[model samples]
Target: MSGPGTAGAVETEPASARAGLGGRYARLWTASTLSAVGDGMSLTAAPLLAYTLTDDPRLVAGVTTALTLPYVLFGLPAGVLVDRVDLLRAMRGIDLFRGLLLLTLAVAVALDRGNLLVLYICFFLIGTCETFFRNASQVIVPSVVPRKLLVDANGRLLAAQTAGNEFVGPLLGSVLFAIAAAVPFGIDAASFLLSALLLSSLLGVRSAKPSTRRTGGPSTSERPADLPAAPGSGVDSAGPVSATRPGLLADMTTGARWLLRDRLLRGLALAAGGINLVLTAGLAVMVVHAHTVLGLGSIGYGLLLACQAVGAVFAARLAPRLVRRLGDEQALVCVAATMAAANVAVWLVPVGTGVGLALAAAACAGVTWDVVVVALRQTRIPRPLQGRVNSVYRLVAWGAMPVGAALGGLLSTAFGTPSVFAAGAVLMTMIAACLAEGARRRWISDPR
Candidate 1:
């Protein structure tokens, strides 16, 4: 059952209706899982190729940065596009485009003609596609599944993401790359094709739109109950009367303004972005640590990544129960504190044993934040603004990734890899402290 005072269709879903998560949501889940496999393989293979192509840690990290920079560049624009288009068409088209790009990239890699510039272009284009794809995935959920299941559904999506992209995808990619440099990417491309086909078949499909309110001059009255709620926003999901289309500039900032004005969302966005910065930094900086400090090979490195992913998989499965038992804020404190301590232990404990265990523990605990926050956002944000709001939130949250990646390179260059990981651990701990205080003060609340 949903929590009391829940205001959406998700709140009123009967037990019988709850079963739709497995049936309808299963299609999306499967589509996401297949897509994640492609993402996982490409993610592991790209970095590996970069490492082989150049010995410079910064260049390798630059590859990571290239993939994430699109969010900083095109996130808001893509969000605006998503708000006004068919959700499946947007996702399906991106998958097709990505597949073609990957296949072409695979050909280049196979011919040994691929260079750093070429790689940067491919990663950037693909990353840009992903920004919309990611947003669409979140936006489409409510149209398919009831709100009561949002937490579980999102958790399941993350678990599949962890399993495919992080664990299974990377593991297979390592093996495939050993046989042929282009094989993993080729497979990834094919996976996208398959993902597109799957998305093509979804029932009850809805075009992605901002949950807009109609305006007559300024001073509009309260929203009528018949409009479609904003996509992905849980707050206005109950009725279907959509909001009026505002100016393009106004539409773009609508989500951003909503995010900034809300205290809970503001706090959560900060916490999310802060952690992304540190984690992205870790991705770049820690690869050096894995190689130099831990003495890990490419295969070993893939396995090490899998360890964190495996823990995240478990966390995705468990987060819903934890949130219900502890409430969102308490769950975040416990999970964040555990992850912080685990990150510190990554450096503190003996290199080989501690590194693996610490990463696993930290990853497991860390996913609680994503599961909780995603569910919270799904329920609370108004549907008309979901896409734009998510984009702006990501603008702040995910925008930090590129900075972290670049900074990781610079920091590792200047302070050394160990210091980078240590710094990340410290920052994570501090973020946790701030979140704990905010939760204690009840800064995060229903704002939609």
Candidate 2:
């Protein structure tokens, strides 16, 4: 999971390794896309599977709740592990583990032995692995591709992720599920295996420095891509030389403090969290909503969601241009408003044309938002703290999903899915207003 130009592998690398970078980057991109496809398949299959097992809104939400809960629990620890572990080895191993688990689940389902309890356990484990894989994936990118091609490479990867996970995966998963419930998971398992195989091709990507914590080397940056660096420390040939590494709690706190210390970073984190809170609320129950409110079959529901991915593809191409045109703050507001609009459409119009278009708009703007945010963070965060700070930022943003999942279930139970959508729309609008105000005051300034 090493990504482009953040922190992982030292800034300097040999030209020989950088030669034929495209092929190497393509392999990593394929790995990422394949894994994303599996994730998308699960997003559709897992909740739908839960619904098949039970009719309770709360219980169905529990599936999503279980999947996301680990981000809050294991995120920082996983970040610590990523810094210490070999990126390719860790990614390949995790993929194998996930693939085996899914293959087992597929077999169980085929045998009619699958149960909700088993689903919960499998999902939790998969989510835990994903926590590590995702973080590492980002860190490993810069190591594989040069900085000049970094943005283009990431954009391509993101596009592939969107296409596989959202466009192809959901539609394909729904079709497979219709043919046979075990089929989607079977494909997901295969996808992971393929991804693992692809990881072996990354011969050039290496840790900037092997982490001393695990390698018995000198201190360095604690990123999956590099060794742990002390606060204000410079990169070293032997390893990072500054203060000695702190305990886990203190190390994690240091990363968190760095992010919170900056007003813009703090605002961005809060905004992302708010966005996730409402977004998860809708997505958690979207399958059910599509069934009851929109009166759509699984195929129709899949297609409806696919529109978002289609729009995202376009967004991926244009995000950099849009950010340059609008600047960061205005662009952030656009992202928030677009999401709000999508939820509003869901609340107001249950039909395909309206909801699909709105969702697509949301997806489009959301990606632009993502591109801007990630690019900004890459510029701002020091390479040494990239792993830790990225984890902390995600810990705040993604932590909202579990809470939103639970709240979504509660809201749907109390007032139905439309109400939840309506509430999300309102919440997002308020968030957009706040961001706009901040922008007007020049609070959310560009890090560069």
Candidate 3:
């Protein structure tokens, strides 16, 4: 039974149309998975290389800060870029450029000519590319798949990302790094090349323009259907549309303005920023923790990541169902609370027992947040403004990462590795409390 919402040509429709997530979406998913593998490998290898170059926890954490700084610095403008160009071509070029960059790094490492400066520069540039690529990719989803299937599509994507980047990539990277430091970089480069090839086959993709008039159902209205119940949370009505393209600064401002004016999105973005800050704080010095506290080598560290990833993948598979069962508002509260508890457990428990279980639980909570919140954004934000709005959202959401990395390093140096988890637990608990109150007041309605 083909419904009005079925995506793609009528002839190619599945016997049960709801079963298909759309062919274009599948191709995007595949390319994303391949790129994730490359990302996983490079992320694993880069920090390990940095640790070898410097024993200082702060310096090692600097590598992470260097990588994430771009999110704060260029995130907003990158959304403007995404809104301006051919998404498929832009993504392809970025992948090709990243592959070459990694290849150069691999050669440098192989020649024993690599230095921390070079690593920082490479990671910074790559992170800049990531800023653009992520916005473009997210914007493309609504165009390829029907709106109703967003949660399912996002869930599948998150699961693949967890499996490839966290599970397969880290495991492979560790083994390869053990053999030769350069090998993982080379493999990472190859994965990017392959991902670029895959993306080349995706045709006729572009960002849609925002429409003032409502289309489809009541859900596509100018304002998000649900507003937070918080008193004084104001909703801004749509402004007059400009026919001519706005200046770059103006375009960026417009997106930022929209996000700030919307209470739910503003709150969500702010909360996400806090959560990412704490999450990265714990993760930035994890290598040091694994080495000193857990007494693990590179391979063991990878295994730890894999264990968390396995839990994330499982949770991603369950996310859509869980969201439906719990509703988006309640899901957010639960995720925050669970992450808080998990981080606390990690701080107190041993690696063999409480730590592993805690990491898994935390990963599961993280996956739930991704599936619920990201899908909410996709559903609520107009397609035309997705890039800018999302970028503005990330400017807050991901911009905190570098600062968190720095904090993690400082905490690790001053109080030891376990302090990072303790701090994260405290911060996440506060967030959970706020979110729980929002849920109790019926702050957000599940767009689904």
Which candidate achieves the best TM-score against the true structure? Answer: 2
Q: TM-score ranking from best to worst?
A: 2, 1, 3
Cα miss at 132, model 2 (Å)?
0.4
lDDT of each: 0.71, 0.75, 0.74
- Which regions of candidate 3 fall more than 4 Å away from where they truly are? 1-30, 141-158, 201-243, 324-326, 379-384, 445-448
Per-residue CA lDDT of model 2 for 350-389, tens digit only, reads 7978888988888777777777788778888877777678
Q: Candidate 2 vs candidate 3: which has greater lDDT?
A: 2
Q: Cα deviation of 328 in candidate 2 (Å)?
A: 2.3
TM-score of each: 0.82, 0.87, 0.81
**After best superposition, candidate 2 residue 181: deviation in angstroms?**
0.3
Ranking by lDDT: 2, 3, 1
Cα lDDT tens digits for candidate 1, 125-185: 8888887777667667766766677766665565566567777777888778777879988
lDDT of 3: 0.74
